[model samples]
Target: MNPQERPSWRQQSPEVQQQVRQDSEHFRKCLDYLREHSAGEHEGFYGPDSMTWVIYREPVILLGGLRAILLQIAHPAVAIGVAQNSNFRGDLLGRARRTYTAMYQLVFGGLPEAMGAAKRVHSLHSRVNGALPAGAGPQGEGRYRANDPLLQRWVLATLIDGAMEVFETFVRPLSTEEKRRFYEESRLAAAQFGLLPEQMPPTLEAFYAWYHEQLAGDALRVGDTARELAGLLFNSPFTRGQLDELLTAGLLPQRWREAYGLAWGLGQQRAWRLLKGTMRRAINLTPPTLRCVTAWHQAQMRLAQARGARPTVMARVLNTLDSYVDVPFSIRPVAAKTPAADRD
Candidate 1:
């Protein structure tokens, strides 16, 4: 049978449909709880908007869990290669390399904000540190130092990996034109950050500046879409003015309006699901105040076993791993720590 003709949840067997309904109901309850409880102040860099709330609530936990699985199942060489080719070696290569490394660790290690809402972030942070080459890891133990090369790489890696996950897991296969458009947009955004194809910056400051700029552009695009949607809703033949007013008043947040760009582009539903999944994994792997990348990794292994992967998904994911490892970066086995020699 053609893959497109395969039965979806709605067309499943009666028992399977019942299970899906139960799961959907559970998910709705979870979402409602998230909407209610995530209102107060946040302890991170982002604020108390719906997007931020969704991010901190369940999605982070889910994404963290996914990251844990990816780390465990994926070969170490794949991680290292992704870290290397992510940026170009150039003037200030040391700083550029460090910034990318930090990005990777932040995403892979899962560092938490200072506000103390999520402690698992730090657990993954420490695990990645332990995994890093000696003299290369998070600086000062808690905060991501601007000067730390390893930390820089971790940060970059996280962004790239997170974005890629959304692309692969959620976005349906795109046409060649769609793929070109997406890359074109990404490239244009990257260029605005002073990231030339051959001259990528090698420091945290440059990376952050560029990264934020890209996000800003994305926000603008999203904002435009939101406005168009609002106009459409308002001008709809069946939409009463009173109802529109109620929706505008109750549902729209100003921040979301301003930062409305969809990271998943036209695939809003899938993007939203992917984002929620990412957050959920992130949170589950490291609950507030706890530090344990190993636990997260173990959890992923269990989940994979439980899911009973089809040979095709397994093969594709493995191919991704192989492609990842082919990037030019060093990978070494985890080593046993030894005591330092005493000074004579």
Candidate 2:
């Protein structure tokens, strides 16, 4: 079945507009649920003890950034939305920095901050809607809204899968229980994006079945728009891109590698294996403070201060650096909001 062939988001249609209102209402409820259940003084959706923090705090997750984006755009609707709405070609690093910052805020910031970040992203996504171009495969006539639940689900899946791949490859493998816990936490995060529980797989094993089917199926087509976006990411007038291309190509699903026309032979495979081994060794030797990202350190500092404990010297230093990068330190309480159509 062609996923993209599903009915498009039509703004003028009363049905679609009603669906949008329903989605907004659902998202607000999800936010309330999170605030009631997961929001502590300093803990966001997933606290410091969560498997999310364990896997995501590692700096190696950065290696998965491109992999996630590549997998996201493999869906034709996503590629079209990105191609139409993004300024990635003109401001790649700035775009990437903002994206990473928002992700960090969602994962590591205080409850209010995480909610604010989620609202901001949802608002921006509310504006991204367009039809696929001609010769865009079988779903050329389909329209897309970034807020579409299925599209959001696919994007979320890519992020989770990419992070899991990088963490397992360059750090250590997780047990089934560990992975299951992580997947459960991810569902909570997914709720922030307006996805209903019924829309997602109920368990980790079920998710893998769905994810593997996506990887192996023709549902993912790397079209012209996707290729253009990939070129912008992989061949910009940025840093030397050899290592970036190597890692992205090596880490992408084998089917997607072929779809994207990335060459992967014995030499590349051997090199990838050697690099993975070296990274695993290096990460094993590194101390946690050095191996973790600044956002993790900032979260630790925030929590420490809330408990009236002095943060470590390294935590203070990293907190200062994180500030320079515009990482959010706090969020004010949520105010009474207007309607989504008006506010967004």
Candidate 3:
């Protein structure tokens, strides 16, 4: 069968068939790559009950992602690795796509696919180690490793924390218990990636205490490479203008804003609040399935329930296409690596 061919649509009316055909062509490559990578026999790190899953798949992934990158590059090693090893600046969209794909695979891909993704990350990180660039603060940390558990912990922490920030800011606020569960699940995910328990602080309190303390000092100060990336990220053109980046900047701690040489004034603060409020209202307006990353699966499940039968493999694949949105390529601008990465 042709990779893009949708034989399952044969019995459907012309309208449905046309829509499915467009979807199949639109998402063919991504779907094919996913199919080629099997989940194998290993069970995934997170089940449906996992809080990590609930928070990770939101529409604000890019918003939280920007914060995660800001946090990652604050680490000199991660900064240096991204500056010297990755082509983030030269091709920010490509970088963003690669990073998000790895994340999606971990969360949604099959077990074998997830493990293979992890190993590939390890291999990539193994090649990204060396001295931190000068002027990155006195506590230079000597060297940076992509696979360093300590670094990995911080990177994962940013993703965990940043996701909550975006979720609460734009999506609905999580309950206190939900927040705690999310952090615990985040730690669980990190542990599977070889991050030790001690590497990740248990609670949100520990995260602020441990990591925030680092941010306040030399350890998390922005290096030249980091600053450059941060500048590019914020200054880049987006369809939404710089409103998205400005909103993100407004959410940053004053100390971090200063570190990046970004000065947020009252005007920016007001604008952020106004825009955020509008966004909050609009989220409710957006379709429920469109808001979450699992929309395809959710839609598929609904269809199966309605049909009173299981969906076939082709059906599942095609449904994934229906949920596809070019997240990284848009947000109206360019967008990761300031904090740690999936592997490290």
Candidate 4:
């Protein structure tokens, strides 16, 4: 469909329209918040010293990306948006890379870069809206706007939940306090990602409660679109490895695992345990130069330069992987074609 021919927020049902306005206002204030808070601090919202950066720097966290994607699409609204508005089915890896890059920018980029990343995501989401078709479960045929904070909350929640699950399972377990700190950092990013403070759970304990509730709740029904896409995703060339099955099957909530008809039994559990142990030991023995993702290396270089010190030889070598790490998303952003007067 032509961009102009797409429905506007004005044409949405009253409930969705109210949500869109609330999300717009909340995101506007979020931008203002970033502008005020992101002064001379070269380190982004969560710096190198933060638990967020520490956990996220581990390459093992990448395992959570698939888990997060599956969880996001399990929401009927998210499924409808992706099935209708995105080319994810044809280019899932590209979609995953974009998501990873945006996350890296948010976690590692300086204030301006982080804000820019947030705006870019908001811009992309601005165009993703439609109604869930019939048979999409209880909420089927309801309006869905990507900017809706409630839906955004679920997406972010899945990331938070998946990251913790993968990190603790593959890397090492986190202390109660460590988990709390990580979640606190996530709450800050949540604000930048369109959530008002009141919309987010106030504490890690509360977040856990909420996350579990959502997982078992009827709201996250895996419908036809999500199920078909997930089947393709796990079976696709990029993700057909045994490790992918282990990750997806092991990390997905039991209800969702059943909803998607993924097989898991005692044998699979043993394999998951074996794989988890093997990865943890191997990663612990690996040096930071080989352990962290390229984005961490790049961030380290940026920080060193900011402090008038050249990055160490090790960092320089690791940074070389930047071009190869997420090659599909290496291109620069295109300027928006829509004129301001014509913009939605």
**Which candidate comes out best when scored by lDDT?**
2
Candidate 1: stretches off by over 4 Å: 1-44, 50-64, 67-114, 117-148, 167-344
Write model 2 residue lDDT over 168-254, tens digit each, in one string.
Answer: 989899998999999988877787777766778999999999999988888788888899888888887763466787788889888
TM-score of 4: 0.86
Report how far residue 249 has shifted in candidate 2, in Å.
Answer: 1.6
Q: Candidate 3, which segments miss by more than 4 Å at Cα?
A: 1-43, 134-141, 237-240, 294-344
Candidate 1 C-alpha lDDT tens digits along 1-344: 22234355456567545544553453344333323433122212222222222222222222332232232112232233223322222223343334333322222221131112122222222222112333222232322212123333333333433443333343223344543333332321222222322233444345446644543442123322234433443454544354333322322223332333212224644544555466446645664323322222222222233344222333233334534463211111112222233222
Task: Please report the candidate that would top TM-score against the real structure.
Answer: 2
Please list all clashing residue pairs in model 3, or write none if there are none: 39-110, 39-111, 39-112, 72-338, 72-339, 73-338, 73-339, 152-344, 238-332, 239-332
Worst 10 residues of 3 by lDDT: 329-338
Per-candidate TM-score against the hidden true structure: 0.21, 0.87, 0.72, 0.86
Any runs in candidate 4 off by more than 4 Å, and if so which? 1-22, 36-40, 134-141, 320-344
Model 2 bad stretches (over 4 Å): 1-19, 134-141, 324-344
Candidate 4 structure quality by residue, lDDT tens digits, 52-152: 88888887888877788888998887887777787766777777778888888888777767878888998778667776666563445566778777788
Put down candidate 3 lDDT per residue, 1-344, tens digits, no spaces. 12123224355557544544453353333333333432223224554456766776565756767777888888777777777677766677677768776776566544555556755665455445445545552344555556566677778777776788888888888998898877766654564455645557767777768866776766687767788878778765541356656766866777776777764778877888898899889987886555665432432343343435564444354444544654331111101112223235
Q: Taking the candidates one at a time, how many backbone clashes does each contain?
A: 58, 0, 10, 0
RMSD (CA, angstroms), candidate 1: 25.2
Rank order (by lDDT, best first): 2, 4, 3, 1
Worst 10 residues of 1 by lDDT: 327-336
Q: How big is the positional error of residue 314 in model 2, measured in Å on the Cα after superposition?
A: 1.0
Q: In order, what lDDT does every prediction score? A: 0.31, 0.78, 0.60, 0.75
